[model samples]
Target: MNNNNNSICNKSVHKKNVQHPLLINFGENQDGDGFDEFILDTFRFVGGRRYHNVSSSKYFLPNDLPEMDRLEKQHYLFLHIWRNNFSAPVREKIITKRKSSLHMAFEYPSAIFIGVDISPIFPSEQKKPDNATFLQNMLDGLPFEDDTFDFVYQRSLASAISEDQWKNDVIYELHRVTKPDGWIELMEPEFLFSKETDAPNCHKFSRALLGFLATLGINGFISSQLENILTSTKLFKNIHCEERSTPIGQWGGRLGEMMCNDYIESAEACKPALSQFIGISHEKFDSMLENIRMEINQNRLYYKTRRFYAQKA
Candidate 1:
């Protein structure tokens, strides 16, 4: 969520003559612990209304998954999980830190977290001692030495790296820094989500999402197949994976209700930005979202989510 670093990074990479004020303001507002506090407060206010007794999800990093040959990427999973499990603030913190700590009660308190989309400006202040770090330097790649971390984690950087070599290099860097016997974890979701009883073409929003990502040469549609990527690396063992389907609009329960409501609100809030960047009309967007709500209300709209976990050899 730290925009300063990313803006600089983006500007440096693009080397363009333009400076975007919205992007600049977004960066400034997204810095430090205060931004996280805002996001957490928002989540508590809205998310509390949806589900009360849900336990924190288990933490997973990008390097963990089964089926090393599957063609799934990490960032898509991170965003889907964030949208499903987190509010804007909580997700901002999670992405900016590139890691998450859900089990402080576990033995290695400092070593446990989910690292994805971590920005250089925001250190891992969500946890005590702050043991993890992610470098955003496109030129420098990752900043860690070989075997520097017990786990390597990331997701949702598809737009940031357009070339296969850059992606491969980043993965190679991650593998080089990961300690032996450590673990790699990844979660990915297909750009589209659908309910079982949805009407024809109701998943248009998801489809458009896929189209946008495809334009960037990003496989935005990766979901439930992360294990293939892990297996291809041949650096991990003891792979474990699971998949869950959540209803989109129906009153499946508190979580569903919260997710639906948030999705609506966030979609509306981002309408202008979406239009500016993606050229989609609000009317069309709302119609699609409304369709999803109807499907959910009828208890037929559902979306698939996948998880992957693996340990190093």
Candidate 2:
């Protein structure tokens, strides 16, 4: 990401203090590609995991390799549940002739891609294909001009962006960039299982998660509520929304097992942040997670996920 023309934009200036030598310090180069430098801080260790160093970001989970693996497993669970590589309906709306896309699903020979993320989670310039370009920028402030894309797709960011940001900043930015009649799709999983769960610890985790999100002014049910949220915005019409339930224990078979791991891993990742939020020690948090893991298997736990695909008015 050190290339002169790289698109990882800088939003917040990071402190130079490193608690561990293994901490990643992606030095900034503002002149490269006219995009600001974006620093991904995973080296700052806390509660035995890593998290973003950006003070303005409200993401509650860790950003280390283990967390990525957990997310990948969750992605696999989605593929298994939907029996497709993606949840959006882009076949006729896109992937036909040559098209310019931001965060597209297909790499059709004629299609060009510009991906945006808060971190350099994608392949570097030397490793990525020529058709794909990436930019590291905060979601609230996109670098593109208005009417810049034929399609825009964002997934799994319900935690990273708050309700206020969605209602006031992020959605408007998306509306501003999307061309009229173009498609915009977003997928967010409730991804939390504190409600309607039979397990005691899972209940505790749920209440804690709700309290944490409330403290940050984020909506806990954005997954199911996003369809109405988008409709209320008045920027888009013809909204297509879908919700799915996934099993979280052995009762759901292999899919359930994977879902179970996704649940526990996510809760565990929040240990560093949420434990403090609820005034608990690291050891007590671990005990709670262990009980949650076993209780889910015995209780037939399940959780809901939702996605919305809409078009600009």
User: Which candidate leads in TM-score?
Assistant: 2
Model 1 lDDT on a 0 to 1 scale = 0.40
**lDDT for predicted candidate 2 compared with the true structure:** 0.61
Off by over 4 Å in 2: 1-43, 85-87, 96-107, 191-197
Question: What number of clashing residue pairs does each candidate have, in the order they appear?
Answer: 28, 5
Worst 10 contiguous positions by lDDT, candidate 1: 16-25
RMSD of candidate 2 to true structure, Å: 8.1
Q: Write the per-residue lDDT of candidate 1 for residues 54-86, one digit (tens) a residue.
A: 122111111111111111222223334444322
lDDT against the true structure, per candidate, is 0.40, 0.61
lDDT of 2 by residue, 147-177 (tens): 6566666767776667777776666666665
> Model 2: what TM-score?
0.80
